[model samples]
Target: MLCYEELREAVDNGYIIGDTLNVVRKNGKVFDYALPGEPVRPWEIVTVESLIDIMTELSNYQ
Candidate 1:
């Protein structure tokens, strides 16, 4: 699982939204992007490391 810090950065950068109730797969893999202001699931796992990679890719936007 990725760290929270990296996930937060991704959320802040608009790379991912952490508001889904239960977007992950049954085995705790794969995540669905949530809309803004949506309620987040209590057991949702934030992937900071994954977010870092996503954000890094998005940073190339001009």
Candidate 2:
């Protein structure tokens, strides 16, 4: 698992997309993080459900 900022950077750079996720999709799209309607990078619909999945995995780590 990675931090939100790092994930956001990855998404901005096109490293994260539909193919990069195994979690359930919301609106048929994947997201990193964004400020809502910031002109440059408006927030996309990043689901809390998938976020839970990521955190659960991280919490189980050594």
Q: Pick the candidate with the highest lDDT.
A: 1
Please provide, for model 2 over 1-62, each residue's C-alpha lDDT reduced to its tens digit, 9 standing for 90 to 100: 34445554655787555423333233553333333333332333343345445544434442
TM-scores for all candidates: the values are 0.30, 0.31
List clashing residue pairs in candidate 1. 6-48, 7-48
Instruction: Please state the error at residue 3 of candidate 1 in Å.
Output: 0.3
- Lowest lDDT block of 10, candidate 2: 32-41
> What RMSD does each model have against the real structure?
9.5, 10.4
Alpha-carbon lDDT of model 1: 0.46
Output candidate 1 Cα RMSD: 9.5
Which pairs, if any, clash in model 2? none
Question: lDDT of model 1 at residue 37?
Answer: 60
Candidate 2 achieves a global lDDT of 0.43
Task: Show model 2 residue runs off by greater than 4 Å.
Answer: 19-62
Give each model's whole-structure lDDT: 0.46, 0.43
